[model samples]
Target chain A: MRGIRIGVCLLGLALALGAQDQANIVITGSRKYQMAVPDFNALPGVAPDVRATFDQVLWNDLYESAVVNLVGRSLYTAPAPQSEADLDSAGFRQAWSEPPLNVQRLVFGSMQVNNGGLVVDGYLYDVTQPPGGGRLLARRYADPATTAGARAIAHEFADDIIAALGFGPGIATSQIAFISNRTGHQEVWTMDYDGHNQRQRTNLHSIAYSPRISPDGTKLAFMSSVSGEPQIKLLSLLTNRLLPFPTYKGMAETPAWSPDGKKLAFAADMGGPNIEIYTINVNGTDLKRLTHSHGYDNFAPAWNPKPPPGSPGQIAFVSSRIGLPQIYIMNADGSDQQRLPLGGYAVSPSWSPNGLALAFAWVRTGGGEDSGASDIYLWYFGQQKYVQLTHNEERNDFPSWAPDGRHIVFESGAPYRTQLFTVAADGSVPEQLTSQGSNEMPNWSWH
Target chain B: MKQSTSRYFLTAVTAGSALLFSLGLAGCGHKAVPPPPVPAPAAKPTPAPTVTLSADPTSIESGSSSTLTWTSSNAVKVELNGAAVDLNGNQSVSPTQSTDYQVVATGADGQTANDSVRISVTQPPPPPPPPPAVQPAPSFAESVRDAFFDFDKSDIRPDAQQALDTDAAYLKSNPNVDVEVVGHCDARGSAEYNLALGHRRADAVKNYLVSQGVDASRITTESVGKEDPFCTETTSECYQQNRRGHFVRGQ
Candidate 1:
C-alpha cells in the first residue's frame, strides 16, 4: 500500500479529567535476547561465561517455550582442509551446512576474550537422534564491546545454520526485546531473539523493563526508570523515540495493552499492598479501575476480549483470592467474581480474542520428575475440561495468544535464555521464538 | 524380589478360592474388603492428630524466586523438572538457571499432597548493544504524502508510519513552526460518513503529532468529503491517496 500519514490534530487533554492526587510518577531493566538456532545445544559444553551462558539459556528457554524448533548450532565442525588447494571445497561445505535441513541437526559453540574484550566463534551440526552427523555451517566472530557481541556471534552462526538447512531461521533468526545492565543500569535492549542483531532501544541510561509489543509489533510499551519512579512508556521501533504514559500517583509498571489498540492497562500501587489493575486511553486519559478488592493483592489483568457471553462487556482475570491465587471471571465493571477450576493454582491468564477458552499455567500435583515444573493448560468452559498443553519440568508462564488465537506464545526457561514459545490451542506442536538473551513478557498483537 | 509380592498375594487368593469352591461356591478370585460400620455415638472423643506439615524449601537460587513462597518442613518429595525429586526433610536447590520446584508435602498419614514453584534462573549479563538497524529511509515527499487518511484507521500500516515519523522528526527538530491539516474522503459514501471518515484519518495523524507534543496552535484540521481531490481518481490507490489529511505551512 502507498504510505499514508495522518496529520496531528492537537486537542488539549480532554476536559472531563478524573482528578486525582499530584502525580508522583516513578519506574525499571531487562535480561533480554533473541537469535537463530543453528544448534539447540550449541552453548551446552561451551565456555560458561555470563554471555555464553545467557546465549545458551536464552536458547533453551525459547525452545521450551515451544515457539520454534532449535535445529542445531549456528556453525558446524567441518573437516579441516587437507591442503591450501582445498579452500574452495571448505567454503562450499560451510555454505551448504548453514541452511535448514531435510534432516534436523544441532550444533554448539562459545564466546571468549580474543583480540579484545570478547569474540564469539561457533559451529552447527546435523543430528536427529536415530541418526546423527555433522556439517560445517560458518565461522563468524564479534569484535570487542559491540552491541550484543555474543548475540551477534550467535546470530551469524544461526543464519548460516538456516542457510544450510534450506529454510528460514526462527526468532533466534528474528529480533527480540529485553532488559540488560549495559550503560550501568537496566534498559530495554534488542538483539536477534537468538542473541543476534543487538541494539539498545532506551538510551535513557536510566532503567526500563516489562516490554509489551503492540498489535503489529511496531511499538513497545514498557516500564521505565528514567523519571525515578516506574512509568509506562510507549516506544516506536521505527522512530526510536519514547512516549511516556501520562504520569500517575504512584508507580505504573507491567503494562498490557488491549487487542483493539485503544487502551493500555498497567500494574500500579494506587493504594494497596500489591499492584492493582488500571486502564487508560492510549493518549493517557480516561483512567478506569477494573478491580477493587480493597485489601487483596491483584495484578496481571488480561483483557479476555471475546466480549462476554450475551452481554457486550466482560473479561476474565487472574487474582490472589480464596487464599491462593486463582483465575476469576468478572464483568468489565468489577462485578460477578466467579472462580475458575484451574486445579491447585493458576496465574498468568492469557485470553484468546475469539474467547473460546483460557490458557494458564498451574502446578501439577502429581508424581514424576516435575515437582517444580509448571504445566500449561486450557480451561475450555464450553468443554468443561482442562486440556494440558506442556508436560515438562520447566518454568512456563505469561501465555500471550497470537492474533490468530490458534497459537499461544509464552516465556520458558531452564535458564537457557528465557525465550518465547508458541503452542497450538489443543496443547500440541510447540515452537520456540527466541534463542539469545532473555525475551520475556511477550504480548502478541492481532495481525 | 520383583515377582515375590505378586506371587504371595496370588497364592493366598488361590488357597482361599479352593476353599470356597470345596464349600460348593463358584470359583472366587479375590474378595473385596467390607465397608467400615457406622461410628458409635459418643460425646467424649479424642481429637484427630494434627500433622505439623512443613514446606520443603527446594534449592532455588536466591533471586528469580516465584512471586510465592512456602515453608512446609515435613513435605514428602520436592519436584524439580516435574517428576518427583525425592527429598528427606527440608531440601532446597540454588538453581542458577530456570528450574521448576514441585514440592510434594505429605500429611501424617503417607497420603501425598503437592505444591509447585516455577523458578526462572537467569544467566549472567550480556555484552554491549549492537549497532542500530539501518533501513534506508524513503524520500521526504513520499513519506509526507502517506500520513494522510480517513478517520479511525491506523490501517495506514508501516510505510505510512515510517513516512509520518520522518516528517515528525523534521517538524520536531525545526521549532517555531506550525502546520494546517486538511482531511478528505471518497464520494462512495454519504456526505456525513465521508466527512466522519475523513475526520478520523485527519485526527489520527493530528493525534500522532500531538503525542510528539506538536504545538496545538501550529496544527489544525478541516475535512472535505468529495469536496476536493488533489488528484483525479482512476484506481483505489489514487482515490486513497487523495482521501487523506496533509499539513500545509504554518506558524
Candidate 2:
C-alpha cells in the first residue's frame, strides 16, 4: 500500500512539472502568446469620449507591443467582464479559450469618473487555467478626467499587462525626442511612442536641433544657435528651462548621453582642424578628447548600453579617418578603436539596447548611381554580418533604437521635408509617426 | 530868170529824188536792230523751300514735354503754328491736348513748304509718393558670399577659394563685424556624417579666411548638416548649391 501511494505521488509530481513546462512554453516560446482585450466597461459619469480614447489607446498599445498576438474583436464570443465578479463565470473562460477565440489570456477592466478624475480597474486573467480562469493581475490607475489622462492610464495598464505576460518592459510609456519645424524653427519636440501628446519643448526662435534626451529623461542636450553659434545646450525637462553649459569655440553638435547618465559624448571642432569626439561630465567638467587624428574628421558618438566584460563601455561613432565615413567602436576612454568592415559609406551608428547590434545608415555602393540612396542596416556583433533593414527608399538616416530593442525610429523623406518613421527591428511594419512640417533626428528615450 | 528857175527846179527835183531815195534806203537799213537779245527772261530763279518738323520724343507721358524742332533751307521765313520763328530751332512744348505742330517755310518767291508733327497728350497719372525713409543697406548675406563644395568633399575648391577671398576681404574691411560660418550638405548621405562634413567645410572656410589675414577670433563655425538646405531640388546643381558654407552676421 505504501509503494502504491509513493508511486501515485511521483506521478502527480511529474504531471505538475509537465504542466509548468507548458506554461513556460507559453511565456517564452518562439510563437507569440495570444491575448484578447475587449472594451473596458465605462461606469456612470464617465464621458463617452474618455472611454473611447482609453479603449483605442489601450488596444493600440498592446498591438504595437509586438509581443502578443491579439485576437481580433470579431472573434470575441462573450462580452468583456465588467468587474472581478465576472471572472467566476465559466462561460467567459470557455468563450475565450475555446476554438475560434483560442487565446491564452484576457485583459478586461472597468473605468469610472471619481471626483472629476479618471479611475481604471484593470485585470489580466489566464483563461487557459482550469476552473474558470486564473487571475494574473489587478491594479487601479487614476488620473485627471481628460483624454490625455485616459491615455496615460491606458498606457500604464498596457505596460502592466505586457510585464505580467513575461515580456520585459513595454515601450508604450516612453517618449521620442525629435526636431520639428512646425513652429517655424527647428525646436526640440517630443511625443509618446505611439505619436500622441506632441509638445514643443523649446522656444529658442533660432535653429535648434539634434536633441538627445538624457537616460533619466530629466534633461535634454541639443545643438542650438541661441548664442549665435552652434553650441551644445542643455535644458532641464523637469523645470522647462535652460541649464547653464560652457560654450566652446567652433561648432558643437550631435550630443549623446552615456548609459549611466553621468557623461555626454559629443562631436565638436573646438577651434581644432577637424571635428573630433569628446566626453564631458553632465555638470560640464572633465572634458576629454577621444579621437586624436589630425585632418581626419570624426563625430556622431553613440554609447553602447551594455559593454563586454572587463570594459568601462564602448562607443560607436562615425569617422572619416580611413577616407570615407564608417562606423567605428572604441572603449569609452577612446582606446582600442576598431572599424566595422562595412565597405560602403556608413554613418549614424545607434547601438541596440542589448549592445549586440548596431543600426546605421549605409550606402552599399559609394560614388555611383546607387550612391544617392542610403538604407539602414543592422550589424550584429555575434554574427559579424549586416542585415539590411530598409530597401531602396528615399534618404533614410538618423536611426534611434527603441527601448524595447524591437523597433527603430528614423527619419525618411526628401531632404527638405523629412518626417520621422518607426519600423520593427525585423524590417516589418514601417509606420510614420510625424506628418506636420519637417520632422527629423528622432531620439528614442532610454527607458 | 526862167532858165535859172528851170535848172534849180531840176536840181531840186534831182536832189529831192536823191534825198527821197536816201531816206527810203536809210529806213530799210535801220529796219530793226533787235534789242540786244534779252535772254528770254531766264526762268524765275525760285527754289521751293524744304522744311522738316519733328519732336524729340514723338510720344511723351502726361505732364512731360517734348522738344519740337524745325529746319528749313532756301526759306526766307518760317512759321511754327502761325507764329514766326527761325528757320532752324527747337521749342519745349507741354501739350494739354493732342495737337498737330505745323511748320511752314516761305521761300523768296512766295512759295511755301510745310511739315507737321503730332504730339498726343493724355491725362497725367498721379505722382508717386516719396520714399518713407532711407533704405537699409544690403544685408550681411547679400554682402558676403557662400562657399560651395563638391559632393562628399570638404576640401576648398577653386570657386570656393574665390568666394572665401571675397568673404575675407569683407571681414577685414569691417573689423567690428564678427561672422559665423555655417556648413551645410546636400540631401544625400547620412545626416550625422553630413553634420561632420559640414563642420569640416565650415572649418576649412574659417581657416582660409584666417590665412587671408582675417582674425580667426572674428569668425566662428557651425554645421547645419543637411537639416537646413539652401536648395531643395534633387538635381545635381541644386545639390551643389545646397552643399555650401554659408555666412551669417554675428550679433
Best TM-score goes to which candidate? 2
Candidate 1 DockQ, CA atoms: 0.00
The C-alpha stretches of model 2 lying farther than 4 A from their native spots are: A1-30, A367-371, B1-147, B158-182, B206-222, B246-251
lDDT of 2: 0.81
What's the TM for model 1? 0.38
**Chain B in candidate 2 has what TM-score?**
0.46
- lDDT for B119 in candidate 2 is 85
Off by over 4 Å in 1: A1-186, A189-200, A204-209, A364-372, A415-417, A425-429, B1-251
Per-prediction DockQ comes to: 0.00, 0.28
User: Candidate 2 on A1-447: residue-level lDDT in tens?
Assistant: 110100012233234335434222112224577899999889999998999999999999888877788899988877778877776776767778888888889999888999999999999999888764488999999999999999999999998998888776778999999989998887999999988889999999877767999999999999887786678999998887999888898778778999999999998888777788999998989999999987888888999988888898899998888887889999999999999999778888998887877889888776323236677777767656666777644777888998877778988776667778877665545677889999988999988
- Residue-level lDDT tens digits of model 1 in A36-121: 34322223223445465447544654443333354445343443333223334424334334443322343445455655555555
lDDT (0 to 1) per candidate: 0.52, 0.81
Candidate 1 chain B: worst-modelled 10 consecutive residues by lDDT = B46-55
Q: What TM-score does chain A reach in every model?
A: 0.55, 0.91
Q: Worst ten-residue run, lDDT, model 2 chain A?
A: A1-10
